[model samples]
Target chain A: MKGFIDLHLRPNLEERVEIERIIKRAAELGYRAVGVSLPQEKLQERAREIRKICSDLDIDFISRIDLEPRNSLELLRSLRFLRRRVEVIAVKCLSKSVARQAAKDRRVDILSFSPIDLRRRFFDSAEAELASKTQVSLEFDMAPLLYLHGNQRINLLWKMRIETIIARKFDVPIVLSSGVSEAWLLRKPEDYASLGYLFGLDLENAKKAISENPKKIVERNRRKLSPNYVAPGIYVIRRGKDCPK
Target chain B: MPKIVRRRYIAVRIDSDQTIERKDFIRAVWSSILRLFGEYGASQTELKMIDYDPTKGLAVLRCSHKALPMIKASIPCITHIGASPVTIHVERVSGTLKALRRKLSI
Candidate 1:
């Protein structure tokens, strides 16, 4: 297995000690890279320090933003402004229009839902079909499973199972996140991959959800974010006449 | 004649806010397994804590080889020990206790 990546940690930057502990724990748990979701301003303010901490711990850092747009208009507006600025953009689909729009948008990297609310999940076959044609991946956060119990956990698993079926039917990609807003919620990558068995995913597909899918998203976005990026599949190596147009 | 059961040992590092007693840790794990897998599933695991160091929060657990994945899955479900939040990481797994201990020296 490749070095795993957990891509949806919401580390609170206000507590420097806490954030460092989380990053170190992530590295200790064998994550090659970790992505932290923050507001735009917080991300801008702390990207450097976060990067430094991760680097010292020998873990790669990614800047991610989660957009909870109420409507398609807001989703589109944020997509345009935030696309080039962050390594990963996950849209929490609150309404039908936002889900549809996010499913088809090229700039959106992940489509996430409220893990606790079945009604908030939006990855139907329709959404999966649209997402399959684009580069977007459906995100499954495991944090809620560790906390919720009884009916809530059952309902979330039921919804997740249905979403998994739809995603698999359309060949849409799926990514697993720890969804750790706090440090203690983190778990080993293998534990999570195994838990994917509770859903419709086989062990191999589940591992890919945490490893290959998220890695590809981050790597592709990194290429786009690079200074030499000219267009998709195009880059500028030399600036002089030697540069090929 | 009785049949011999193949067993595996899991070396885990417990990350918690306070030093944990071995009995409490094992009980918490049992509670978690019961919650997630129910009584029959818990019985199948044959879960046991072989060793624990309260000062270091390191321990070794024994379970049926076939139930390895079940043990791994249930560990994450144990989020707290009496309100002091905790997380456990499986450092390594081995067929023999000696090998597991040698590998863990963490």
Candidate 2:
């Protein structure tokens, strides 16, 4: 069975639902896993607590840290420190340099470029090539659509269409995140897929953004964090002396 | 002689705190389509609310086959109807309303 996972879901603040309640709702919504965004400070303590609750509910909960760095140096420092700690590392692109750097970094799992960001055109073919080469997925957050209306919404959609075209041209992985701050805002995976279609992704590619691409990032990072992992595509295993050579 | 227009029925399930009337629901969908795709695309859809159950929050909507993607694309764009917030989920789509109802057990 194909698993559906929402790669970005923030803790419900306005609704103030308990963490367990959020996990239960996500499960009911047919999500096999959900990535919960947490603050960078005290990440280890919070992740441990959330992981326990998710385990009891039989839902794969990924601890994600979202960073909005002011410069490339800050971004790299945060990435170096947090990569080993969290299951997913997402950097919000605030400048052209940061966007380009994040796209080329192997440690970065997701580069989030919102339509409301400062850059008129945040992503171009160059960044797309870097993203494709480094295996970093460009993220499109759906939260803006929840509030923006009329021409504002239309403009965001137009920008998204251009970004999608560039990403598709370079064959860069495109991932969709709801960026929901409230529990009710959490949408079903199929809805995200439909939204992807509006952004110019075909049905298959859109579905991949919601499922396969994110799953691959999680699995790859999980292996890299394992004790036996030496490097990418290399693992070390102890051989028993008693076994025939 | 005019050829028959191929139609598709989408089974939509509404998730909300309060029950929404069928009239209000159709109005919401039309306004959403208009907002997202503009007047020309809205006319092209030929959208209609075929059947709706307020209690269950399930509805089967009919649209031209070519406009199915446009309709699906617009479902998530509807954030609210009146003052009540709602989320629309497209459960299934089929060639006939009868087939959609049977598959969805509506």
Candidate 3:
């Protein structure tokens, strides 16, 4: 499985070299794909530039677009170019109304709800709004707000257990991300396993939460996924056809 | 000629008390002693112990050179091989090819 970082492209700072370097480093480290974190304002020009970069490097580029009206317009416009070149469009929906609109306007490879606030009152509503859609999926941010409440430190095991239970209940497809702000912070799969174990994550479910489900996003979008691919229950690159249940 | 790398060590620390059955005691500490020896380096330390038995309630650890520091740092509780209260010292030696290869490189 592969993972990526969001380049919070700051203005007036030359991002071309830095972005290229980051991509180069990622490729060297054996990442399967990369995603750009685009603010609503700069989607048009930057998407063009990123498309070019991805072409030159032969790496898959995914555009993570915010689901605000202003950003949606830019994303919708870029969808023409993106239809052929880009791998996936990650839409972070603030509201179900915007999500439905984006779904209707352009094909979103992945739909994620990254609400900064922790009320969770809106999740059922958001889930209901997109309940009918197929091919598009959801991701959990594991954000501090979601895991930790005021004056409380959340147990990682309990959180994983709960999320797995909830995901099963809703039959919703989910992906796990570190929500990392830096590049050097990439963690090993074993580390995630230990954490999952600490949080009551069964070995198979923990593997799926980090490795299988996230890879599904790329496999769903791309035409040429790697041959040595591992998926849910299937542990490739090893002797085992399936992880021991 | 390849330079010899420090591979393993053995520590047999003698402790007071000599009342309980020695063989069963050594069997019980076997797993813990091995685990502590393996975690000597970031990867596989690849250490091994030949034998630990009862002699005046003494504890003994046989491990690899790279694993020496870790073996040194660990509490004697793991290497304590006898039934009675005893201090154990670790003696280490160069491991076989399989062990060294497992420890070498990233």
Q: Best-fitting candidate, measured by TM-score?
A: 2
lDDT tens digits by residue: candidate 3, B23-63: 55545444443443333342444544444445544333455
lDDT of 3 by residue, A1-245 (tens): 35532212122214577667655544543444556665546666777787688678876665555343335565567655454444556666665555665544436655555433333213353453353255455554433322343233233324445645555555555555544333333233333333343334455665575566656656655542344445534434554565555
Query: Can you tell me the DockQ of model 1?
Result: 0.62
Model 1 spans > 4 angstroms off: A241-245, B1-4
Which stretches in model 2 have alpha-carbon errors above 4 Å? Answer: A12-18, A118-121, A239-245
**DockQ leaderboard ranking:** 2, 1, 3
The digit string of per-residue lDDT tens for model 1 on A84-189 reads 8899999999988999999999999999998776787878888999999997999999999899998898788889999999999999999999998777788999
lDDT of 3 at A38: 58
Fnat values, one per model, are 0.66, 0.57, 0.00
Query: What is the per-residue lDDT of model 2 for residues A1-245, given as tens digits with 9 covering 90 to 100?
Result: 25988888887433334667777778878889889888877677777888887888889988898888888999999988889988899988888889888988999999887666435447888889999999999888887876688677778888888989998888888888778766666678888788776668888988888889889889888889888798877886764784468
Could you tell me which 10 consecutive residues in candidate 2 chain B have the lowest summed lDDT? B97-106
DockQ per model, Cα: 0.62, 0.70, 0.02
Could you arrange the candidates by lDDT from highest to lowest?
1, 2, 3
* Per-residue error (Å), model 3, residue A90: 2.9
lDDT of 1 at B99: 91
lDDT of 2 by residue, B1-106 (tens): 9999999999999999999998899999999888888899999999988888988889889999999999998887788989989988899999997888789875
Go through the candidates in order and give each one's C-alpha lDDT. 0.88, 0.84, 0.46
Ranking by TM-score: 2, 1, 3
RMSD of 3: 17.0
